[model samples]
Target: MTFQLAACAEMLWRDRPIDWRASRLKELGFGVGLWNWPAHDIAALERTGATFTIMNGYLQGRLADDEGADMLLKSARETAAVGKRLGVHRLNLHGTGLGDGGIPVWQHDKVTGPMWLKARDTLNRICDLAEELGVTYTLENLNLMEHPGCPFNTTADVLTLVSSVNRPQLRMNLDLYHTQIGEGDVIRWCQKCLPWIGEVQVADNPGRNEPGTGEMNYPAIAKALKAMGYSGPVGLESNAEGDPEVALQAFRNAFTV
Candidate 1:
C-alpha cells in the first residue's frame, strides 16, 4: 500500500491566498485537499500542479429524511460538476446531524432504524451520481467531543453504514485525531475499516495540532496504516505552530515510515 501526504490548504499558511497555498503545497510535493468546495477559486487551483484528493460533499441537509432527498442530490450534482472539472477524485460528506423536530438523527428508537435506512438509500443515490461523475464519496466519522450529535461517530457505526449501503462509491474518511478522542483504538479500528477506508486525516490529540505536538504516536500510527494496506492519501488537517515549514518537517518525520 503506497501512502502520500496531502495538505489541507485551509489549515496551512492561512495568511496567503488559495493559489499561493496550492503553490506552497506543490513545492513540498504534497497533494491538495479541501474541506469546502473552492467554488470561488477553481482557477487558482487549476493553475497549480498539485493533485486534488478530496473536497466537501453535500451535507448541509439531512440524509435520513425522504423529503430532503432532493437537497442532498442537488449538493451531489453540484459537487460533481465542480469535482469532475477540477479532477478531484473523492467527495467527503458529513451527513446532517439534526433531524425532524430538531431531534438528533440517530435516536435509536422508532426513528433510528428507519432514519439509517433512509440515509443508506440516500447515499446509494448519491453514490450513483458520484460514479457517473467518476468520483467516490466518503462518509466521515466525526467524534462527539468536537462534533456532537453526529451520526456514525464510532468505527462500528461507520462500518455499519458502509457495509449496509454496500456501494463501491461509499467509503470511510477516517480521521485519526477524532478517532483517538472518540475511540482510542486506532490500529484496531483501521483494521476493521481496511477495505472501506478511502481517505485518512491526522492531528495530534490535546491540541489537534500537527503530529508530535501531542501524545499521538504518528510513526506507529503510520506503520499501522501501512500494515493494514491503506494506500490512500493521509491528509494533514491540523494547526501548524509558528512557521509552517518547521511544522511540515516535523510532520514528515513523525508520519514517514
Candidate 2:
C-alpha cells in the first residue's frame, strides 16, 4: 500500500516564496507541511489549495510548568484557529518552545517526577482544547544534539506521554529523523508508536536531507511501516540535497511500498 505523501514546504525551495513552494508541492501531487503559520501569507496559501497535512500547533509554550502550561494552552488555542482556517489535518507540538537555532527556550538538564506529571497534565489539557476545536494535535520528538535540554524530546518519552494520555485528539508525530539520531532502532520504534501515531516524518541522518542522501535505509523502513499497517501520512521534513523536485521524488520512491 502507498502512504499519504507530503513534504515540508519550509524546508524545500528556500529561495522561492512560501506560497510558490506550497503551490509547487501541490502541483507535484504531494500534500504540504508548514512550520510557524504567522511567517507566511495565509491568503496566498489558501489560494494554493494544497492539502496541508500538519503545521506547528503552538507559537510559544512549554509542557512542564504551570506558567508554561498556561502559555501553551493559549498559544495552542490561537494556532488552532489558523489550523482550522487552513483545513490542516494535524497540528504539531514539542515539549517546549524552541528558540533561534532550534534550541529550547526553557532547558532542563534532568527531568524530575513532578515535571513528568505536569507535562502529562498539560497534554491532557491540550487534548481538551483539541476536542473542543475539532482538531488533532501531535507531540513531536526532537533529538538531543540539535535541541539540547529540551524535555520530553526522546521517542520513548514522547510515546510514554501520549500513551499515558491515550486520547485520540493527541498523538505522536513519530519523526524518524530524530529517532535515528537519538535511538537507532527505527523499525522497532515504529511498532511501538504505531497505535498512537498521527503522522510519520522522515529525513536522513548525518545531513538532514532527503531519504537516500544519508545513512538511513528509508526504502527498508518504508517497507517495515507498510508491514506494520501504518498507512498514514509520511512527510519529508528534509532539505533538498540538490534539486527540490529530485529530493521529493526520492522521498516518494522510498515510501511507495
Candidate 3:
C-alpha cells in the first residue's frame, strides 16, 4: 500500500501564508497535519484543496477535576466536529499530567492513580465523541524526558491503554522521534503493536528535525512501515532547519513509492 507524505503546519508557520503552505504541499504531492490549528482556519485550508490528515486537540492535566474534565470533553468534541467538517479523520492527543504544587498524573503517587483512571475514562468519552463526529482518536506516546508525567512513554504502555479502553476509535499515534528518544526499539515495537496503529509521525533523532538531516535511517524505517502494510500518512512532524522546501525534498528522496 502507498502512504501519503504530510507536512505539519507548525513547521512553516513563520515563513509562509497558510495557502502558500498548502500550495507547497500540493507541489510535493503531500498532505498536511493541522497541529492545533484554529477552527476558523479550516476554510482557508479547504480553498487549497489539500487534505488535513491529522488534527491535534489540546489537553492538560490541570483539567482532571469533574468540572475541568467536562470542559475538556466539550472542547474535544467540538474539535472533532471541526475536524470532521474539514474532512480530517484522525485526531491526535496528549495525556494530561499533574498540575503545579501537586502530584503528577501518571506517577506512583496516590493522586496519580486516580487522575490517570479519570483521564482514561475521559479518553474513552473522547473516543465516543470522535466516532460520533466521524473521526479516529489516537493517543500519542511522548518522550520520557519531554513528558515525565505521562504514563505512556512506550509502545507497551500504549498497547496496555488501548486494551483497557477496548474501543475501536481509540488507537495509537506512533511518533518515531519520541520512540527513538525514549530508547524504544522502533521496528520491533511497531511490529508488535501494528494492529493498534492509527497514525504515524516521522522525524530524526537527537534534533527532531527533518529526516536524513539527522541520524535516522528513514529508508529502513519506511521499509518497515511498508512491510507492516501501513497505508496511512507518514506525517512530517519535524522542524525545518533551513527551508521547508528543502525538508520536503529530503522526505521525497528518503521514501520509496
Candidate 4:
C-alpha cells in the first residue's frame, strides 16, 4: 500500500504566497502541511481545497507549568477552531513554544522528575481538550542540537510522554530528521513510534534539505515504513536544495515505495 505523502508549504516555494503554495502542492498530487495558522488567510487556504495534514497546534505556551499549561490550552483552543475551519488532519505541539530560529521559548537543560510529571499532566489536559474539540493532537520531538535545552526534546522523551498518557487523542509526531540527528537508528525509532504515531515527518540531516541532498537513504526507509504497516502521512518538512519542484519530486521518489 502507498503512504499518504505531504509537504510543508511554509518550507517550500518561499517566494510565493502561502495559499498559492498550498494550491501548487495540491495540484502536484500531495497534501499540504502548515506551520502557524494565524500567519495566513483562512479563506484563501480553504479556497485552495488542499488537504492539510498537520500544523502547529498552539501559538504561545509551555508544558510543565500551571501558567504555561493554561496558556497552551487557550492557544490550542483558538487554533483548533482554525484547524477545524481548514479541515486539518492533525494539530501538532512541542514541549514548549518555539521562538525565532526554532529555539525553545522556555529552555531547560535539565528536566527534573517533577517537570516530567507536569509535562505528562499537561499533555493529558491537551488530550482532554482534543477530545472535547473533536480533533486530535500530536506531540512532536525536537533535536537537542538544533533546539538545545528543550525539555522532552528527544524521540525517547516524546515516546515516554505519549505512552504514559496513552490516549488516542494524543499521538506522536515522529520526526525522523530530529531522530537521525539525536539518535541514528531511524527505522527502529519508526518501529517503536509506529503505534502512537499521528504522522511521520522527514528532512535529511546535516542540511535539513530534501532527502536526496543528504546521506539519508529515504527510499529504503520508506520501504521499511511500508513493511511496518505504516500507511500514514509522510511529510517533507525540509527546504529545497535547489528547484522546489525538483526537491518535491525527490521527496516523493524517496517515499513512493
- lDDT winner among the candidates? 2
Which portions of model 3 show Cα errors greater than 4 Å?
Answer: 59-68, 97-112
Candidate 4 lDDT by residue in tens digits, 1-257: 29899999998889999999999999999999999987799999999999999999999999999999999999999999999999999999999999999999999989999999999999999999999999999999989888989989999999999999999999999999999999989999999989999999999977999988888999999999999999999999988858989988888889888
Ranking by lDDT: 2, 4, 1, 3
- Prediction 1 TM-score vs. true: 0.90
Answer with 1 or 3, whichever has the higher lDDT.
1
Tell me the tens digit of each residue's lDDT in model 1 across 1-257. Answer: 25778878878888888878888888987888876664448877887867888888764555778766778788778777887776886888765644443344543323377778888888888888877877898887777766657665566777788888888988898888888998898888889888888888888888878888898888898888877777678888878866787777777787677
The lDDT, on a scale of 0 to 1, for candidate 1 is 0.77
**TM-score: which is higher, 3 or 4?**
4
C-alpha TM-score for every candidate: 0.90, 0.99, 0.86, 0.98
Cand. 3 Cα-lDDT? 0.72
Task: For candidate 2, give the lDDT of residue 159.
Answer: 100
lDDT of 2 by residue, 1-257 (tens): 38999999999989999999999999999999999998898989999999999999999989999999999999999999999989999999999999999999999989999999999999999999999999999999999999999999999999999999999999999999999999989999999999999999999988999999899999999999999888899999987859999999899889888
- Candidate 2, residue 48: Cα displacement in angstroms equals 0.7
Q: How many backbone clashes does candidate 2 have?
A: 0
Give candidate 2 regions above 4 Å deviation: none
